[model samples]
Target: MPVPDAPVTGAHRETPEPPGGDRPSRLDPAIAARLRRTPDGLVAAVVRQHDSGEVLMVAWMDDEALHRTLTTGRATYWSRSRREYWVKGATSGHHQYVRSVALDCDGDAVLVSVDQVGAACHTGHRTCFFTELPVSSGEVAS
Candidate 1:
């Protein structure tokens, strides 16, 4: 079935041209159609550990990637550099199984809760925030 030219809130109306075609029927038409993307065609997804509430990583998600994640029950993101869709744990043994997703007030950012297995950071760390930046007081956050 041909997807309708629905009205999308914030920014221009997406042509409903999801990368892999129409979004799965399981996803609400209104909610799935309302995804807001930057001019560069991306939104921010913040991944956090479901149990410990520790931040795992932040990644970009275009409309298609977001749909992929919602439909597949896995954390999927758009690779800005590589220009591709990547499913978490596709390559590495580390995988983030989506537990819940929360949209920010602006609806542009998302907080994804996941049952993470192995390391969340590609560098083999539990989280990507292992490094701390020094504050104006010349003291780093502990």
Candidate 2:
């Protein structure tokens, strides 16, 4: 078994740890636990197009949602409005097949690159971030 706090190497990288723990200890549990969840117990997930590298949409994920995403090789999220778990494209047939998942160093956010099947946005657009905010002043934006 790998020692605690050690850098996991090689094939072990692909082997996800078994879920249902209070916190992950295989790597640095403290570091991973740094991920801040909202008072409602949610974190932000950034989903992207794997091949074209197009920015898709951002969503919220709870622990179960995140676990489902990792184990199933698909993008899953916690629907804040519906008050339920959602597998992307489950209804629209525009599913997101997860290619890889990465956590930022701060453990505050997740990036999921996926093979998007069709339109990623519910608005029938390729991405949800279609409208750009007007830049009133270059200095303000900078």
Candidate 3:
């Protein structure tokens, strides 16, 4: 378990601990209590198109990113590569307007349903998962 005062490694900005020092995060207490984060303090967020049920992308969210997404009704993510917080389509103009957010049963991942305005994939595809993976054809044993 991480210490309450330890800085989140990839967060864009670190929030100073309040005087009492018992609070583990700046995220809403209710939401924070449910999250099971990676060692780097991130949760997997699987974004999907609300109408088509097409999975758009998978992103990472720290507590702050999740909080921002919840409060703003926009998709926000913590970019591991960029080491920053990025609002979806902020640069590409392909926005994801959040419809709903759900935490998975294990509390390790979140499902983000959104109204995707344009291409969800950065490569101009509809979704990030465009390649088909072949499966072995086999009969089930009865």
Candidate 4:
């Protein structure tokens, strides 16, 4: 299926188009290339907290999600269970502002350093994985 043209947003929309009648928005070519390579497959993003260096979450990014994150300077992800692009903390108050973004060696994964406002987990924990299972005992503990 053909993808629709992405909607223009922010002050750029008010600016006049180039001589060509339409100007492409500022998105990293490398990121775009990675998205195109993946198609509908998974692209993992390792979400890290800026101050503590904690890995808050690992979310997937679709083309739209990656575009939104780059354009808005916020964290966005493609939710496999929901089957949609979801802006981080859109409904919740725990928004994540992008500090920096990087692609992995194979270009199939991403690392996003962010300023996480509140809990990254839905369960009110600071991180998604609240409890860890002990390998030796095979017991789950917080």
- Per-residue lDDT value at 43 in model 4: 76
Model 3 Cα lDDT, one tens digit per residue, 22-69 = 323467889888989887778999999998899998999888889888
lDDT of 1 by residue, 1-142 (tens): 2221121223232353345433233446676556676766677999999999999999988766776688788888766554556777776768889999888888789899999988888778889899998867676778
TM-score of 3: 0.81
- Ranking of candidates on TM-score, top first: 3, 1, 2, 4
Query: Model 3's lDDT to the true fold?
Result: 0.78
The residue pairs in collision within model 3 are none
Q: Which scores better on TM-score, 1 or 3?
A: 3
lDDT minimum window of 10 residues, candidate 4? 2-11
Model 4: per-residue lDDT, tens digit, 64-133? Answer: 5677787789887755554545667766667899998888888778889999988887766778877888
The weakest ten consecutive residues by lDDT in model 1 span: 1-10
Give each model's whole-structure lDDT. Answer: 0.73, 0.70, 0.78, 0.68
Report residue 100 deviation for candidate 1 (angstroms).
0.3
Residues 1-142 of candidate 2 have per-residue lDDT tens digits of: 2111111122132333333323222324453466676666677899899988898999887676787788889787766554556778776778889999888776668899999987888877888899999866556543
Root mean square deviation (Cα) for candidate 1: 10.3
Better of 1 and 4 by lDDT: 1
Candidate 1: Cα lDDT at 79? 63
What TM-score, to 2 decimals, does candidate 2 have? 0.72
Candidate 1, backbone clash total: 0
Q: Against the true structure, what is each candidate's TM-score?
A: 0.74, 0.72, 0.81, 0.70
